[model samples]
Target: MNTLNSNPVHGATRLNDWGLIRASGEDAAKFLNSQLTQDFALLGLNEARLAGFCSAKGRLQATMIGWKASEQEILLALPAEVLPGLLKRLTMFVLRAKCKLSDASGEWQLWGLTGTDAEQWLGDAAPQTRWSLGQKGEATVIRLPESGAQARFLMVQAKEAADPALNPLSPSDWQWLALQSGLAWVRAATHEQFVPQMLNLELLGGVSFKKGCYPGQEVVARSQYRGTLKRRTFLYELEGQALPGQEIFHSEDPGQPAGLVADVASKDGRSLILAETKIAALASGSLHLGSIEGPLLQPRPLPYALTEPE
Candidate 1:
């Protein structure tokens, strides 16, 4: 991890750039304002938003931590490897809207945080502290700092001459936090593979029931209202190594893959993993990995509760 500002950011890997793309123009807000599940219209100059970029059918493309840099400029911070395909898909919809989507990845960077040290650390070091979702920026870029007991943030390039703060925490710390958050970044292997709801986007605030129409809005809404959601994401802990995309098995069905590992973090020898699976497949007791004798997965309660269908 790249070290910047003496590693003031906790729960962050290297002080590195999270690929940020700016979609700016007269039609920008009008365009995206119509899309995305979150309310971009409510985002103030310094405020940041956590949103999902979904396919026209409503499956997730890539998740975003977006902010309004200016009235005409909005910045979306996302995974770099996933940016190219996302950009291409977003560009296809710009046929009529006067939006200009371009790669601003090299021009800016990102910083992540969690644990007790994140908030106070950034407050002490980063310039201008408009920390939460509606925080006003002082000619600088600050994504909404999560305003809770669990802390996180993404710092952007404030000016043309500005750059990322290099200080970073240990890679292990970052792994731990990502696992806790249950983030499932869209990789090539998993791209367009799982629906947003399957990744627990609804529970994570990545979906807005009150928001207007966007791609897949109907499907997302149906899943919530009808409650026929057979699959959902769950946080799991295992005694063995947790591999991303690795198949998890059940004692009842050894022939079918029950779920896939989304992300993992190692702490105290036992590893925590985020897995997407069928709700009926998981239970309180032991579940075999491959054979009925494989390591069992212990279920843990999420930080928040799932909203019941209305």
Candidate 2:
């Protein structure tokens, strides 16, 4: 097991692994609403949406935390590794929609804030609801699901803006806290491998079924209404390291793969993994990383409950 250096409980960390995509034009919101899993047409300034961009087969290509920057512009924050391809594909669909998609990573800086550091940054104006947006001068603050009791937030601001006044939090600790929050953002390695529900996106308010049609709307809808969702993302603790797209094996059925790692983060010799696996495979509670003989995985309770499809 690799031991990670410990970090302070309250501080801010610049998220270098994330990037921004800007959609600007009169049809910006309309264009995004037609392509993404969430309803963008009604996206409000004070709210943020956790949305999925999917393929025609319903596999998620990218997940985004997006909000309206203005009436005709929306900003999407996603893993930097997937930005180039995702931006290119999004632009292709804009043909004559009056929407222009471009890489905006250079225009904005992203930061991950935790615990009291986030509270101190927003002062009395902190947003209380998850996915809610608040502003501190020029910075846009979005409240994310907490990591246990510690509050977590994503702050976005212009590159020229002043940095938040807080101690520095290490990147490893910030990542660990993100994994603990049970939200998995799609990375390049795991692209097109899961439907949004497989990662509990709907439970996290990342999917909007009533929003009408999108790229994979029919497939996503069928999965939700058919009551055939046998796979789900779950949290597990392991002694060593794991990576995205790594196969997870079920002890009883080691001959074949049972799941894939959606995201993982390690700290102080232990790692937390968010994996999507068949629900039945979890019955025996025997899972392993890498191979069947690899490190044993211990199931951990997610912060939120999974709701059954009606």
Candidate 3:
């Protein structure tokens, strides 16, 4: 495992790829808790939760970081490409629930911060632990898990109130760090392609096993207790660019695809990706990116331990 020195520094980057969905109304929390994979009804202001919206068959349609902005309002942050569709789908189910969902992407500015000086940049109180939430001026800062060499946080502020001192960090750098952290951010191309466990959502606290039934809850529970999971997400590095939804083929199984790329971050000449594949194929076959004849991918250790079915 790779380790970083405990020393922290100050760095900031604009996250243009992310957007927010604001859920506000009398029944916001109750409505979301009943629809998503996280426990939103009990989400406190001091914490954030990683959550997933899955299809009826248990395939993840979206993955997001959700936090309670107020007792009646919750904010969900996710990749911008899927925000519009997801927001629409979520609204369709609101029907008579005392909740209103809307796209708040233009109203909020999202930023990524790293180093010990992060709190100083936000000029607000910041959380002390991973996945914790803090208030900074008009911004909500949520500390993200440390990835590879740096501790990180995600800050969401009203666009008009965003600080100008926060320097822009490369989006690719942010993506690489996120990939290293082993948390998959589902994008449009990969939507409805993975179950929560296949993306290691459970390990990341994205799934609440004790929470009341949500979409695909039954399938998810059965997969957990029946020990029927055969595929899981893994991290890998390759020497070229790759996109989400790209197929991976094992050398031994040339006629069949072994996996699909979940997410990818490329910098300079190399790319790092999260791929969901058969556990058995990972153990015995040589995986190639794109196709059986594509570039070979070297498997890298995930930051967290995977709980395989017994």
TM-score of every prediction relative to native: 0.81, 0.96, 0.94
Local distance difference test, per candidate? 0.64, 0.90, 0.86
Q: Positional deviation of 257 in candidate 2, in angstroms?
A: 0.6
The global Cα lDDT (0 to 1) of model 3 is 0.86
Q: Candidates 1 and 3: which is better by TM-score?
A: 3
Please give the TM-score that candidate 1 achieves against the real structure: 0.81
Worst 10 residues of 3 by lDDT: 1-10
Q: Rank the candidates by lDDT, best first.
A: 2, 3, 1
RMSD, every candidate, angstroms: 5.3, 2.2, 2.5
Candidate 1 C-alpha error for residue 264, in Å: 2.7
TM accuracy, model 3: 0.94
Model 3 spans with C-alpha error above 4 angstroms: 1-10, 119-124, 164-167
On TM-score, the leading prediction is: 2
Please estimate how well model 1 matches the true structure, expressed as its whole-model Cα lDDT: 0.64
Please provide, for model 1 over 33-147, each residue's C-alpha lDDT reduced to its tens digit, 9 standing for 90 to 100. Answer: 6777677766676456667777767777777777777788888777787788878878888888888999887765455544455445455434333234422143243433232
